[model samples]
Target: MLYITGTPIGNLDDMSYRAVSTLAAVDEILCEDTRTTRKLTNHFEITTPLRSYHDFNKETATEEIIEELKAGKSFALVTDAGMPVISDPGFELVSRLQDESLDYTVIPAASAFTMALVASGIPSYEFTYFGFLPKSNQKRQEKLTEILHHRKTAVIYESPHRMKQLLKDLVKFDPKRLVSISREITKKFEQHERKTANELLHMMDKEIPLKGEFVVIIEGYEEETVNFTGTAKDHVSELVNEGMRPKDAIKLVSELRGMKKQHVYDEFHK
Candidate 1:
């Protein structure tokens, strides 16, 4: 049996009893970083042997680990922090495990994005978790555009260094949109600042510190009430007639009416 466990994101006290005992019982522990997991194991007095299993060695490690599992070795998979397979190295292994008919289960624990969202006070009834944005400018802009047009609250993870750039992009796309910036979650310097995109942009260096991991919660798009008397296609055509590009017009109509861009595009083009 493979146990996919959750480790504390920050404060060590958040480690659950089951997680500790399971780690202690496992024959071997597969970790992204042995040095980091070492601290946790040492604190709990768990002597389970740890083997490196990260993105670099994932392909080869998966095959070896699967054979060990076939030989009845019970191993526990863990990331440096939080749950495994969540923007971490476990999805491929899990998929391979399923293919091999191997049994595995997850041990639930805190997630930074979920914690940030709850602390954000944003509308959480509906949400979309976008683990991390693309690094390239063009790809990132396309992703930001998708988020801007989405009707559901969006959650994203970002590195400390890129936080400022992300805020600037948000401000450029939609300054008035409300956003919650959470940093160092569950840590000593943890903070959650709620403000408009533009406000946060201006306060980036002045108020918000550029340190630790960040979870950005963007409020869902609110439909704008426009006094337009026409069908959806007609609305798209009307915007295009007013000097807007066809694609831009479609995007605008979709956001304003809370409809999918493809639906609007199809109607307009037909």
Candidate 2:
């Protein structure tokens, strides 16, 4: 039985008893970094042997792990932090395991995504979890564009260095979009801010330490009100004039204005 164990994003006390037991009991533990896993193993006093399994050697690792699984070995998979197979190397192994009909379940623990969600105070009843934006500028722009059309709240992970650049691009595209920046979750300096991308940039200048890992929660693209401040509103009004009802026009206008439907309708017609 393979176990996908979630480790603390921070704060060792966040580790669950089940996670410790799973780490202790597994025949072999796979990790992205042996040194980091050693810290966790040492902390928990888990004696399971460790094997390195990172993205570069994922394919080779999967082959070895599969061989072990086939031989009736029970192993635990963990990453440096958070859950494995989630924006991490354990995905290939999990896919291979599924293909080979290997039995596995999660020993879930703390995740930065959920920590950010809770800190942001956003509704999680309906949300889209986007692990990370593309690293390339073009692909990242494409992803942001796709997300701009999404209506549900989105949870996204990002590196500290690129986060500032990401906010810049986000503001360039749409400055009014609500975004939440969470950093150093579950740690002494843990902080979360609910603001627009532009606001986040300014906030970072004033408040954010900008030194830790980050998870960015973006409010999904909602149609704006007619009170919008830019050319985007003109595009929506143009759509309304093209045989579209005021209601539909308001919907389009709201896509950029972040205003009420009636206000958009009134402004569209007025």
Name the candidate that leads on TM-score. 1
Q: Tell me the spans in candidate 1 whose CA falls farther than 4 Å from its real position.
A: 225-270
> Please, what are the lDDT tens digits per residue for candidate 2 over residues 49-139?
9988888898777898899899999999999998787788877788898999989999998778887888886667789998888776656
List model 1 lDDT by residue over 1-270, tens digit each. 999999999999999999999999999999999999999999999999999999999999999999999999999999999989889999999999999999999998898999999999899999999999988766676677667667799999999899888887777657888999999999999999999988888888678888889999999876551256788999877655544567877888887878999999889888
Query: How high is the lDDT of residue 32 in model 2?
Result: 90
Could you tally the backbone clashes for each prediction?
0, 11
CA lDDT, every model vs. true structure: 0.89, 0.80
In model 1, pairs of residues that clash are none
